[model samples]
Target: MLVPLTRQSFEQLIPVIATSSQYAYYWGKFPDFLKRLLISVVAVVVILLLKFLLGDGFDPLLFLLGIIAGLYWFWSPVYWASRRNIEIRRYKYSGFWQGRVLDVFVTEELIGTEENVNNRGELVIVENRERRLNVEVGDESGFTTLLQVPLRRTHKGIVPGQIAQMVVMSNQPDLSRIANKSDIYIPRLNIWVSDYPYVQRTVFSQVSRQLTQAEEDDYPANRVVKTRRRRR
Candidate 1:
């Protein structure tokens, strides 16, 4: 389901909006709400088992901290990678749009797992890669919105031009954004590849550039505030 960013639409939809629908495509249950609950229950069960096996000598406080850390390690990616209004950004509202891919590229990342008893359990090193795909789209006003979608997988055979669609949400003024899990529909291959869905394009490129520069015309001149801070 798609909802526009207009005030009236946002007002009417927030109450009825099944925020989980965005994630229902993957996790039939709630990823942020119910999923978290299940994870907590399981962690509690494991901790309980450990306490039983270790007997009265078990330190609940330390076990609680371990549980917290484990939860962080497990759910941080779910909460971070698929975050919505939780983070500060140019956009708060979500909608939908259709577009095409103008270019495609891949970013190789080494995703590995290591376990330890006395340290930050699993060490995660995300090697950032850029220049994945070029997507061309138009808004309701018919202005071109160009998006650069970073391919999340290896060896994604995306061409320079292809048909695709997205569920887009725009921020205020010159900025707008899409969802992170929203897939790029490739009609030719009848397949969807894991790639960046949170794309942004200024309503007017020149105007966006000017505002960016004017924002730098200050005591901190020439420095970016990095308002739309994203962490994986």
Candidate 2:
């Protein structure tokens, strides 16, 4: 099933910025507070270096830099949130597509390497491995894609035949060819698996209900038309 999205379908990103783990995850686990602190530290270091190199006459330039840094620190979160909102808005005309889970599998992924001290007091490189769950889904038109997430105890119940919905962006408004990646939502499990938080949950739930109702209403009519054709 495919349904076009409206302007209201998108939520204000600023309100949910702090609550989104996916946003923080994309920045290598740096939370908003940490980001502010890091930026402040770097700005101070740069100003001190400039003072050492240029001597006393560069006070005005250093003051300007400080103001810029302060403004950036204050508005950084809003800037990032706006960028994310724009990404989702690009797919608004492409419509939402619902597909069925064709298969489900788990794989071990090497996320990174950690340095650990062994019993002999020597640093050893330890590979950090994580279990990832992959769900293969496809629409009636045979368009398929894989949705992956970290395998957690909460995700153990996902299985084949579950409904997976996502915004399908395409150059053609008809969605003949996909253009970008989108967040996936599994309505049955109330689980959203995505690399980023692109969809507004409340709006998505309302749209999903409307689509399901339309499908239910069309079922009997479709069966009646088939029966009449058979009689003919």
Candidate 3:
């Protein structure tokens, strides 16, 4: 899912070009069911053939292991996320792309279920919270980029129609509107941003102190006394 980001918020908005790369790199090459079915079918066929050839000496339990391994190899979300995270860090980690905040909003939670494998690899059931963001970018253009990002991956608020900036790799600089950009070193990605505002405050206060002769040397005091009694 694409993360929601506005410069007004605490997170960064998804980079227009990077989002495309994100999907192409992260999501399953095929639909989940299709991939799972392929894994099970191929593994079962191989396991059955092996058992038949080896006689009863071979354990049928090997079929389950084969299915698990095949599924992990081809369609595991954990594996994909891990790899994608690494790629993002390596490529889009330092450089930044700045743009105006066109829009900011939240999306309905996506309800779904996936394998709830624990650290020990035990299966369980749990509801997944797939938060998403849909932000339209581009101030003036025939085409605008709609950025879809996961909320969990987002945390910034520049507000609607405000100037926003974020990190993108040097290779995909075309993704952002503004060009001639350079590397902006920041800690993380996916945030909201906006134009800075003016604030008013009182800065000075009265203070008591004693000054020595040297401290007041710049302002020399000269006094003269004159009497005009005769003129009276």
Candidate 4:
């Protein structure tokens, strides 16, 4: 079950967060059951090819073993590593969520289950607090409301409790105008996102300088004062 948290809550959990590259790789690219089935077929084909080319006398048992070995090597390592990594770093370990707050506001909520194009969907029950709430959620993905993220991967810094003050759109009267939200887990073969709003652009402005490990010298304290005097 998904639990909610605040930015401060997430910050407290960052220290223990797992930073495994192997986990990140798969968690960031988890596949579905159908895809796993396809992979098994490919594995069998590969085993057959190896036996035909190298096995002077094809041993059916050996070929079967090779297929099994291939599947084992492919699935277990990727799946378990990713799952373990996330588990090690999750709130269960740290006991809270951590992240920034971008903005919070309330609109009519659309609560219902949605269907996926390829697979069955879940029953999403959203309770649009009867009273409009200035909900503070992470807006890194332009998703003000709940988003169905993938199991293996997580959109970094887009954790719950982040805030976004600026808005490109406003709440609808009936909430029926809400566009269908995308399931982040749905894999796309050739997904090409166009004109999408990236966090770097929206999160920071040209006038703002990002911080680095090495601290840079601060701007002269009198700089602003001097500028103000000059304007006068």
Candidate 5:
């Protein structure tokens, strides 16, 4: 038997059925406040300089040239430098995992239980969560690194032996092959150090250490600093 619907029943269900939409917008840009400031400063300075030199003449050509000079002085370098530093740089993607960081030291060789394998031959191990990073030299000048990251929580989402996606910037396509277990380098995910989670620093330091030891100590002029995203 169907029970008849009533107004009181519909009213009681309305509040529970309504869902508020929440929007999270990442990487929003601010209005160019500095651009306005640059325009104002250039207008004032050019007017004053022309008043001293041209003595209040109705010269539109001189005014245009002065505007161009102001733009070059104030905004051109800022715009170009920001563009080269941010838009042109390449970035790697680190994996998302449901586990806490386990800071472990990396070394030439270590003993741990087999964890899992990704499509590449990288090895996963059930080792100490409190581990230290170690960089080791591998075949053909290949590099190996150990990273220690804190595990914030425990979850079954990432089993004891599972390979997760992690990305690193590499210029050589050959380096991409190293993530496999058969390769010399192994990659891990969800690792954090000094409260900053990620492997970029550890990876760079390890590479630098290996390079220095190999007597190839030279800093590239165009090294880009890896920055962490600000948490809301």
Candidate 6:
């Protein structure tokens, strides 16, 4: 089922930024924390090098620039969060769509590697593997997509046939086709799975609740209409 979303709030973007930063290496890439640290270190090194070369002639503007760079590095997550929001807003319309979980399975995935030292003091590269849950979901529109997330203890209860919902954006107001990648939210598990944070989750949850309540209220009335037609 698809329900139109008429409102969105950016106030919850702080949590989205936090989640994205926390899962920076979700796709086996360099972690955001380490990346920011590296940037800060590089900026400091460059500033010191310029100071050493210029002796007493060093420009204070260089120092100010280095500080600005550091601030930008720290604020990168917020920048990305705002970009995601703008991307979502570019669509003519957006809606919440609930589909069924067609399949659920777990697979071992190599996330990265770590260095370990043996008793001999020799460093060895140890492979890091994580269990990932792959879920296939589809709706009546025949649109099917696979979502993968690192398997966690709390996610052990996810099974087939559960309701999975996502924010669907489209260039057309009717939302005939999806215009962007949306994070999947499993209402039953109360968990979200995605390569990146794409939706303002708090708003999504509120919309989901409203849609579910509306559906429940309409079911009996629709059933009564069907029964009356049969009697005729």
State every prediction's TM-score relative to the real structure: 0.37, 0.69, 0.32, 0.26, 0.23, 0.67
What are the runs in model 5 whose C-alpha is more than 4 Å off?
1-43, 54-61, 65-82, 85-87, 90-168, 175-232
lDDT for model 1? 0.43
Tell me which residue pairs clash in candidate 1.
96-168, 102-160, 105-132
The top-ranked prediction according to TM-score is 2
Model 1, range 101-170, lDDT digits (tens) per residue? 5434333333444543445565555454444444453434544545454443432444543444443445
Residue 89, candidate 6: Cα error in Å is 4.8
- Give the Cα-based TM-score of candidate 3 against the true structure: 0.32
Worst 10 residues of 1 by lDDT: 220-229
lDDT of 6 by residue, 1-232 (tens): 8776664432342232435443353323457667776887788788878888888565787778778767755666666666665655666677778886777777778899999999999999998887777778888889888878776666666566667788777777787887764778877667887656666677778867766654434432211111011110
Q: What ranges in model 4 sit over 4 Å off? A: 1-31, 56-65, 69-232
Q: Considering TM-score, which of the candidate structures 1 and 6 is the better prediction for this target?
A: 6
Candidate 6 residue runs with Cα over 4 Å from true position: 6-35, 51-60, 70-73, 80-92, 112-127, 213-232
> What ordering of candidates by TM-score runs from best to worst?
2, 6, 1, 3, 4, 5
Q: Over the stretch 153-199, how does candidate 5's per-residue lDDT look in tens digits?
A: 42112222222222223333433433311101222323222222112
Best by lDDT: 6
Which tens-of-lDDT digit does each residue in 33-143 have in candidate 4?
A: 456566677777777777788775768775667768557535654656545434433322111111123332334333445444533565544433222222233323344
Candidate 5 accuracy as lDDT:
0.32
Model 6 Cα shift for residue 10 (angstroms): 9.3
Residue runs of model 2 more than 4 Å from their true location after superposition: 6-36, 49-61, 67-78, 84-92, 115-124, 213-232
